[model samples]
Target: MAERPRVWVSQPLFADIVGRLGEHFEVSATETVVQHAPDAVAAALREADGALVTLNDAIGAAQVAGAGRLRAIANVGVGYNNLDLPALSAAGILATNTPDVLTETTADFGFALMMATARRITEAERWLREGHWRQWSFESLLGGDIHGATLGILGMGRIGRGIARRASGFGMRVLYHNRSRLPEAVEREHAAQYVGFEALFERADHLVLVLPYAPEHHHLVDAVALARLRPHATLTNIARGGLIDEDALADALGAGRLAAAGLDVFEGEPAINPRLLALRNVVLTPHIASGSLATRRAMVALAVDNLIAALGYGPDAGRPPSPLNADALTHARKRGA
Candidate 1:
């Protein structure tokens, strides 16, 4: 019998769903969640034919330097910033990500967070729980209004479009800024107008960040950008945390330069800036934008499908559904790897 290919799962995932990989490969799954150091990640991938990783694991050139056996990496999230594409391509390894499956779910959470920030939901709850809501004072717990407001979205991707569609029911005037403008039909369908980057900050009553992270986008929301926002505007980030300068945000919120903020992802996540925690106006959540049970399961299933196919064992063998670097597969084949 031919030897079965080996695979590594970086963190504990849905047991039954990930167990499916066992049928075709020798699976090495971590029992507990771990913050893998670069060297540790390299050690694990050194012997595996493929890996199933989440955002928690960072894979780069040094990690895959001599990982000749690593052929594919199935990322369980839409964003692949955790994986260094150039490095993986040089290593002749295919990469796949789970997209579309979490689009609506993430958008739902993004809008919810925005509303919560605008209405001071969590802040109110905390105050009420602390016995501060003695009576309905006219000016008590005042917050920005959502209905008939200008909703500005950065990054007009699928999730951004979903948020815009939801905004229509609230009678919001939607504006968006992206790398390029969406087609006229799409703009009409969502009733979203394209605007320049600075104009988005100036015109928005509420601004939501859904842009993917890139090196150039690091700290895109610094003090200068925050100053562009109206003092009454709310800022919500359902995107990557590295996109915001948390200290600058904290300063803005502390000084009341901005109304409020809702953040789902933070820089150095699982360990947030203490400054944000001190601010009462900022609402923070552990990254759970795609936390809906059904959607999360779908993401895992898609990743499983990608892994099985990329490893050349499933019905769609050699044709992963969402390959990030398909050319790597061809390169591997040419070298008879």
Candidate 2:
């Protein structure tokens, strides 16, 4: 008998969906959602043939350095920043992510977060719960209107376009800034106008960020950019936490420079900034943008499919869907040949 290839599941995901991997390979999955230490991740990959990971697992260069058998890493979320692409590519490891499946779900959450921030929904709930309902006067808890407002989108990706289409119902003029201009037909389809990066900050009454985070975009929305926003404008971030400077955002909220802000992701997640916590104007949520039951399940299913295909199993064997590093396989074949 031949030894079966082994795979590791970095976190505890849906059992039924993860069990699919066990059909084709030996599976070692964590029992709990844990923040794995770098060395621990390295050790697991050192033995496993592939891994199913979430954002919680940070697989960097050091981790892949000793991963002699690691052929693939299927990330459950759309973002692959948690996995070091350069390191994985150099090590001939295929990296795949679950995208498209969560786009609409994430857009829904982004809009909901924005509306909550603009209307002070979360703040009002806290106030009412705290016995402040007695003070609910006609003029109390004034919030900005969503209808007929300028909705600015920082990234014009699939999620951002979904948001733009949703905005059409509210009759908002959509302005967007992306790395490149979307096609004219696409711009027309969503009724979104392409604007310069600074114009997006200046003109939008409510700005929603759906941009993917990268090293160059760290703290992209600092005090300087926040200052450009109309004093009454609201900002929503369903993207990466590192996009905005928490200190700058807290200062803006505290000093009344901005109307309000909604944040789903944070720079230091699970451990929030105390300064932002103190402010009432900000709407804060633990990262759950793509957290609907159906969407999460679909994401897991897609990741499982990606992993199976990546490991040379399933119908799509040797061609994993949504591969970030398919070239790694070519590198492997060249070396093997």
Candidate 3:
């Protein structure tokens, strides 16, 4: 019998869901959590026909320079900024990500985080836990109101629209700034107003960052942008950490320039800024916006399906549902033809 094609799973995932890959191919999955360096990823891919990776593993030109046998990569997250798409395309490797499944789950968390930040829920809990709530002072732990406030969303994608729908229930006005204005129909569906980048910062009562990270977007919310916000306005970031300058944010929070912040993703993940940790006003969660049990399992299942189909081993062979570079697959087929 022919040998089964080899696959490498770069991190530990739900064994049962990932075990599905074992039925179709030889699976080499990581037993422990590992922060894979670029060179380490290259070494693993050198022997793999395909790889299942999470955002923790960064795969770029240097990582895939000698991965001659690597044909497909299934990322278990919606964002693929960790992967170098141009290099993968040049190498004729197919890359896929799990998208739609995590949308509502992530949007749910974004709204929750925003509410937590605006209401100072975590801060008040900590104060109570420390036995500081001896007397119920009327002025203690005051927070911004969510209802009847203007919500400014930096990115108006599917997740952003979901958040807008939620805000409607609270009677909050939804304002969004995106690369392009959403269609009038979509605007009506979400009851969202289109605004410019500067206008969003000036007008929002609570600002939520749902934008994707890119090289150009580094420090998109720096001191200058924070300066535009109302002194009592809150900031919630369910997006990438690189979008905000940590030092600037810490200074803003410390000096009371901004009311508070809720951050899920950080710039140097797993190793957050020490300054952010020192501030009580900032609510920090370890990059778990889509952390619900059901949602995570769905993500893993979708990634596994992408891998099986991308490798021509499943009923949907050659038609992975979320191909990042379908053009590369087409070119390869034409070359073979």
Candidate 4:
């Protein structure tokens, strides 16, 4: 009998969901959520036929070059910046990411973060917890209102569209900037108006970033762009942390140039910028934007399905979540033939 293909789970996911992988392949899952070293990741790929990874486990050409047996990788999140696509394509390694699964949940979190930042919900809670209710007065913690505000979105993907749909309920004038404008029907459904990038920064009362991360876009929101924002405007990022320059943002927040920020992702996550930590006006959360129990479980399940299908074992073989690196699957089949 032919040997079963081996699959490595880079992080601890829902056990039951991960167990599904075991039925199709020999599964090896880490017991804890580990910050895997590059060497460790490369070592695992060397022995495995496929890998199930999250954003934290970055796989590139350097890592995959020597991974002769590695044919597939299933990423548990929507973003694939963690995977070097060009590198993966060069190596003919199929990669898949869980996209639609986390869209609504992440959009929900983005909107909530905007509300929290604009309303000073987290900051006021901290003050109350420290027994500063005695200092409370009508004007003590006044915050900008979310209703009747101009809301700008940086990316108009699925999550961005979802946010725009929610914005209509609050009567916000929705403006968005994307690499390309959405279709007229899509724009009508979301009630989002396309605006130039600079215009988005200048006009919005509340700005929410949902842009996909890319190398060229690192620190895309720099001091100059932040300067374009109205002093009373609030910024909320549920996207990648590298989008904003932390020092510039901190400087803006400290000088009262920007009202406040709500951040769910950071540039150097797990280790946030010290400048952001010291600000009471900012709301910081560990990267848990797609962390609802149902959504996370669904993500793991989808990733597992992707891994199974990518390895040509499941009912959906040859048709993974994303038709990523079809050339790789063709190469694998040719080798098998």
Best-matching candidate per lDDT: 1
lDDT of 1 by residue, 47-148 (tens): 999999999999999999878899999999999899999889877899999999999999999999999999999999999999987876999999998999
lDDT of 4 by residue, 1-337 (tens): 8899999999988998898887878888899989999888999999898999999998998788788888889999988888987788666689998889899999999999999999999999999999999977889988999889999999999999999989999999999999999999999888889999999999999999999999889999999999999999999999999999999999999999999999999999889999899999999999999999999999999988888887887789867877566676666666667
Position 9, candidate 1: lDDT: 96
| Residue 203, candidate 3: C-alpha displacement in angstroms | 0.3
Instruction: Sort all candidates by TM-score, best to worst.
Output: 2, 1, 3, 4
List of clashing residue pairs for candidate 1: none
- Give model 4's TM-score versus the native structure: 0.97
Can you give the TM-score per candidate against the true fold?
0.98, 0.99, 0.97, 0.97
What's the lDDT for all of these models? Answer: 0.95, 0.94, 0.93, 0.91
Instruction: Report clashes for each candidate as comma-separated counts.
Output: 0, 0, 0, 0
- Sorted on lDDT, best first, the list reads 1, 2, 3, 4
Model 4 regions lying over 4 Å from their true place: 330-337
Q: What are the per-residue Cα lDDT tens digits for candidate 3 across 1-337?
A: 9989899999999999999999999999999999987788999999899999999999988887898778899999998889999888877789999988988999999999999999999999999999998877999999999999999999999889889999999999999999999999999999999999999999999999999899999999999999999899999998899999999999999999999999999999999999999999999999999999999999999999999999988888988989998777765565456
Higher-TM-score candidate of 1 and 2: 2
Please report the candidate that would top TM-score against the real structure: 2
Clashing pairs in 3: none
**Candidate 2 clash pair list:** none
Residue 298, model 2, lDDT = 99
Clashing pairs in 4: none
